[model samples]
Target: MSMFSGTIQTLEQSLNYASAKNRAISSNLANLDTPNYKAKDVTFKNYLAKELSQPLQAKRTNSKHLSFQGEAQPAGYKTIRQHATSYQHNGNNVDVDKEMANLAKNQIYYQALVDRINGKFGSLQTVLKGGR
Candidate 1:
């Protein structure tokens, strides 16, 4: 496959994940004032791990070659996750501090993912255009 295609595909996946995470964080922030509002988050790592471990091919008879792990394209992301039960005296399950921290972390991760995609494009450009 072309380098551009690969980069585009990866970027699309990252963008999807970041957007979903943003939605989750927004929901948590919005429910801060709501009573017994448990924070919700996707099982990102678990889903990703299972996706990674899945076999790509239908069936391979030979055991000599390296077994394929997963598919070329991602199975996409999911926003469906579990809720965190709140134990606060105020009845508000939303923890502002924790949610804020999570938001910051997600922001950083989103930026990093973007940077990596940018780097991929940059490398392709460098390869295409001879050095000055």
Candidate 2:
């Protein structure tokens, strides 16, 4: 099994991704009036695909192989600008409505992830207490 096979780890990574996306969306909303400020977004689909495609394969027979610990984590997210649509008269492509909607969606997702993580910890605590 891979190190990230743990549900807690997955939730942690999701929290990070959501946080990054929140920052990007907040920035776009903040610069809605700035001239030529294109909206930016952080996509994690590629990272998810890469992580799913490559499973952990570790061989700990020799000393050299022992040092290896699964495959490296997926690369960081890339904040790409939204150049496909321009809702405002200026060069800015940030649509206040769309950004607000995205903000709400991201918040919901972030809360879900946090709840899941808390649930996992709660379970662990119960187990540690010998079902008390």
Candidate 3:
């Protein structure tokens, strides 16, 4: 099987994405008191779409087979600045309430992904044990 084959790969990617998003949200919350600090976020959908759009090449079994070129997988998340309207007079855009909500939501998502991955591994273990 290919390296990126199954729900496990997707779940791993999602966990990484959510972790990165959590960091970004935490950073925004951290700098809420700093002057002129802009909020930032890492959205998984856009990044995941871009990654999924890339064509994964198959391994050549024969020497005479044509070689395929593909882009390397993303190593880390890309955080982008949030450019929405600011409510603070100091030009800071970090909304504490919204950040807290996002943090909670992200935690739930991350936990769900981890649980799903664990389930996948458990299923694999069952198969290996001959359903014992």
| Tens digit of per-residue lDDT, candidate 1, span 13-115 | 8777887888998998897787666777744677677776766743456777666655643656666634446557756677788879989998998899888
Q: Give the backbone clash total of model 3.
A: 0
Where is model 3 poorest over a 10-residue stretch in terms of lDDT? Answer: 68-77
| Candidate 2, 57-132: lDDT as tens digits | 5657677764433575654566788888777788889989988999999999999999988888888788889998
- lDDT, candidate 3, 1-132, per-residue tens: 753255777788789889899999999999998878999999656766787688666568899987766754754567899777686999898999999999999999999998988888888888889998
Report the C-alpha displacement of residue 131, candidate 3, in angstroms. 1.4
lDDT of 3 at 99: 96
Query: Ten consecutive residues with minimal summed lDDT in candidate 1?
Result: 78-87
How many clashes in candidate 2?
Answer: 0
Ranking by lDDT: 3, 2, 1
The superposed Cα distance between candidate 1 and the true structure at residue 88, in angstroms, equals 4.1
Q: List the residue pairs that clash in candidate 1.
A: none
Each candidate's clash count? 0, 0, 0
lDDT (Cα, 0-100) at 94 in candidate 3: 94
Which portions of model 1 miss their true places by more than 4 Å? 56-75, 81-84, 88-91
Q: By descending TM-score, how would the candidates be arranged? A: 2, 3, 1
CA lDDT for candidate 3: 0.83
